[model samples]
Target: MNSEPANRRIVRAPRGTTLTARSWQTEAPLRMLMNNLDPEVAERPEDLVVYGGRGRAARNWEAFDRIVATLTDMSDAETLLVQSGKPVGVLATHPDAPRVLIANSNLVGKWATQEVFDALERQGLMMFGQMTAGSWTYIGSQGIIGGTFETFVEAGRQHYGGDLSGRWLLTGGLGGMGGAQPLAGVMAGCSVLAVEMRPAAIARRIESGYLDREAADLDEALRLIDEAKASGTAISVGLLGNAAEVYEEILARGDLPDLVTDQTAAHDPLQGYVPAGWTIDEWESRRERDPAGVIAAAKVSMARQVRAMLAFKARGVPVFDYGNNIRQMARDAGVEEAFDFPGFIAAYVRPQFCRGRTQFRWIALSGEAEDIRVSSEALKGVVSDPTFTRWIEMASERIRFQGLPSRSYWMGLADRVAAGLALNRMVAEGVVSAPIVVTRDHISSGSVASPNRESEGMLDGSDPVADWPMLNAMSACSSGATWVSLHHGGGTGIGFSQHAGFACVADGSDAAAAKIARVLGNDSSVAVFRHADAGYPEAVETARAEGLRRPYAEALRG
Candidate 1:
């Protein structure tokens, strides 16, 4: 019996790079552990290289080193490339073949494991692993090719200039996808400008001591760029935000000098911003729907636009987009969905909430049942009577007929009802006990008011009011109970909310609660119900009155 852990398959490492025997197996075993991955062997075993020790830590480091060495070697290629993680390999292709570069962090292989690598490699292009030493590793017919940090810095220096006097602009600094691209340019001898809406985000940059204290927001960033341009500096501008809106706005401004944006779409919005040329760093290409639908949709749209814009690149216009290649590869492979939302959510959410005493159950409800149950005379006695029929009709119309800009705003409601009913059925069938039903209730007075005013008050709160019982119901509900709830106004009610029956913690209670509270105050209206105060039924009555009866009945049925 070989008696070795399956993780021990020889993976290719860069030539001239040191490696341990055990590192060779990491890719193989890691692939096996993942559900969708298949282990890919090197085309030629002799071309395969290994690094690191058999022991876990050494194996991990060696794997990283291999990626770094490969990327460093590839950066020497002719094409201007931007990569995620580390730029490991630059393709040296025939004149007819488009130049390709793989830029990613070495951590991609180590953490994403072999499954991701196999999936990426199956695209039939050269694969490179980004190295931690600020380099890249190219995996190919000849084996691992390497590059180094000095090379990347030199490339960046050559591209941006040595004095760091180039004009640079950045946006979306307030959100996760937003950050200091201009700062990178500044480090590369470009004058840095950043635009961010979130005060806290701006504060964070200031606190980090990264950006020039004077540059904040789009206008300020542009002013800095203009100032740098007057000083005879090379200019690079970056736009950041949600792809659609930010790009649209940047194009509308019409003032950008040498504009560059992280827009996934290739066609630069000609209305406001025109670029001398753009470069794209294809960050996320294949994303699964379900959990990651929103992000995937955005990326897909960006990729499509980028493909369309590639032609402009040949017109002597520099446009950066990564869609043409990825889309073609994806289409060839017939992969309908590439990104995994469930996997992402599970990876991100499960550890934080699942393991603790805090527990959550997915409850789905039938829209019809919810309407009938909440409107029943039995429940209406204590709870305010709502116009259930009207609300349902409106929701249905919005989903089916209205061309609302935000489909999620409408379809999500129906999804919530359906999911709640499904959950109710689960409870009724004993698949789960004490499941909580979540739904959306309307509290806004303008055109979308529920008939039950007081119930809405208790649930939605016209202004800022704290209902201890409602908070208790939510905490109790989160533990082990089927509670009826909805998405929108629940931000004001229970600490639980839903997007098409997919449950999420209330917005106020999201990971940044403390920071938000610090801004909103300890006694802010947005405070979510705490677990310590779990004992309220008044809110339950309000819920019951508002078509939450099916979930309540299902919960009580047991």
Candidate 2:
């Protein structure tokens, strides 16, 4: 990690000019791990929290140091075994084998609840590795911005005639993923009123340019929203108030915004959620001393919040849950109709997933914007898919590079590997400065079991079957991924989901080319197979068109 001895706090990965490890394979994991800790990439690096509620890059500082030391000295023939961010063992393996194999937050099904997980966690037995956090694949907030933008765009299409001019959106809880909502809504041409209790959270969004203004109260927030809407200007306003109370007040007045949703950390009641009437300080103190009390209070508050959201749906305004499992919390708190609204994924993202159009990210190892530009152009040159070509051009023009000058676009299985191989050739030809580090969410198809979110309402009802991600990880490692990981409790919280992820470095070598071709192709092919298996007609057509040898998919298609 890059650092000066005078100030040890700012740790970023070293960039420019060559490989430090024994080989590029070893170098990829080492640099990517440090990149995850870079101040620009991580949400809270000092605490090792990368993003989400408590998703960490490593188990602890000690573990982080050890992992770095291990990766620095380990050879390509020796594979490091990381269990929940701790490097526990090393074993000799073939060159094609992954340099690192990781399993994080895995627990027996019966013992997967938060109470048991916490006991083991405090004993240093496990850590919650939310999606890309522990897997060393996080591409910062921009990664999520694309998905959020798509949701609002879909909302506009469904309810606002494909345009959000002179429209406004109302949502709550501006934590990590939720913080993207304001910017996404504005980007889709709608003003947004985001209700968040924490002043620090509101300030963070404003500083990041995700929010345009912060209002003192609901009246001021409403005024700002109205003014922005009237001017046909998109803006985001952060309201300083409890989400539950704010939504309820709007419900009482029968003056609701055009859309409703939430991104509060309601997945974890004790830690992620703040109870109504409790100050941040009190909430923190009580979380340590009275967790049960905190959970109870938070559940009641979430119920009220969901009740108000249901009121918006009742009034015929589009309402959805932003994948925090807040509806479940409210339902558990005795609000029987809490699930009246759908999750954002179920509403807008699943169709894209069926077509294998999901978060496809690549990082510029050189950390140079020109490298990204060159690679994007290189990718655009080879692929004739007009959708992808247009997206590449639009992304390079519109999306600001965040945390390592990375870029992501949603492409299906058909052309994803084509793009990867094109970028690899560019790197080999010296058209770009460094290799592109490709990554995706841990919850890619055939690689996640989340009943409430990604796998919700599966045709075959395989949402709780946890073996898919395990199979996906094995496939990745066998297909020549530099590193492969399987994680539990990624997005929907502990015991709720299991997923896997992989990182492949494209360094412009024959070996790198072969690996990228196999990994990217197979990785995305599994998504097509997964959706085909689930009876998605589009996926079945894609599988046949791509010549994937899935007999069951063929039979199902027939």
List residue ranges in candidate 1 displaced over 4 A. 1-166, 169-180, 192-203, 213-217, 231-240, 259-289, 304-558
Question: How much lDDT does candidate 1 score?
Answer: 0.26
Highest-TM-score candidate: 2
Q: Per-candidate TM vs. native?
A: 0.26, 0.94
| Model 2, span 113-142: residue lDDT tens | 989988898898888788888998887766
Local error of candidate 1 at residue 407 (angstroms): 48
Tens-place lDDT per residue, model 1, 189-268, is 54544443234444543443333454434576576577677887634333233333443444557554332323111111
User: Can you tell me which runs of candidate 2 are displaced by over 4 Å?
Assistant: 1-8, 383-399, 553-558
